[model samples]
Target: MELTSGWADPEPMAEGGIAGLSPYLQDRLEREAIPKSGKDALPPEQDRLLDQLLSAAFRE
Candidate 1:
């Protein structure tokens, strides 16, 4: 005869998983907006946010 391990039967798995929650917060205020003066250049607020996102994603 053969012996079996103490493991139990398998369980069912879900067909799908949950989604992330960051994209919903893509606010314009957090992005680059044209300056009131109409000058065409990168917005400071976007730069700040980019730095923050990078730091948050790649921090040790």
Candidate 2:
């Protein structure tokens, strides 16, 4: 997916905001709670549906 803007956005981070966190803390915060189980965890059809939805939403 392409983002029109860079990752840095001031609006998302202000006083008492998530943006002010240290890099280590940010990494921790960004980590997914779910453990990966390789291909067994995801079906190929689900990925196809997600791709279709995103494509439709972002299409000109």
Candidate 3:
């Protein structure tokens, strides 16, 4: 007969679960997990477009 701790061992995030997801989704999840302030939260497409627009503005 043995007693057990009520709490279960925590699972590691890098080995399974999210590892099963596609790389794109994994990157999205990782980005979402970290909190960002101001403009850092913009999506990659938006950032790229914004950068292109800024460069065009400078070229004019």
Candidate 4:
């Protein structure tokens, strides 16, 4: 996983997930501007996978 402080060039967290909240927030911000190519889009199961990843990543 990649971690960066700047918002300009945020890096990947997992295989496809972004490292920090910046990229995620940025994607959400420009969501409408971005095209739905349907290729990179995640399936519903991916959301659960992400939850598992995050939970594991931040486990105390």
Instruction: Name the best candidate (by lDDT).
Output: 3
Task: List TM-score per model, in order.
Answer: 0.26, 0.26, 0.26, 0.26
Q: What is the C-alpha lDDT profile of model 2 across 1-60, one tens digit per residue?
A: 877886675434111234233445444555753222332332235576579769889998
Q: Rate the local accuracy (lDDT) of all candidates.
A: 0.39, 0.45, 0.52, 0.50
Better of 1 and 2 by lDDT: 2
Question: Model 4, 1-60: lDDT tens per residue?
Answer: 777665677554323323223456446645656432334533336677688779889998
- lDDT sort, best first: 3, 4, 2, 1
Compared with the true structure, the alpha-carbon lDDT of candidate 1 equals: 0.39
lDDT of 1 by residue, 1-60 (tens): 777777789553211111111332222213544122223323335566578778889997
Off by over 4 Å in 1: 1-44
- On the 0 to 100 scale, the lDDT of residue 6 in model 2 is 68
Worst 10-residue lDDT window for candidate 3 reads 34-43
Clashing pairs in 1: none
Scored by Cα lDDT, where does model 4 land? Answer: 0.50
TM-score of 3: 0.26
Clash totals, every prediction: 0, 0, 0, 1
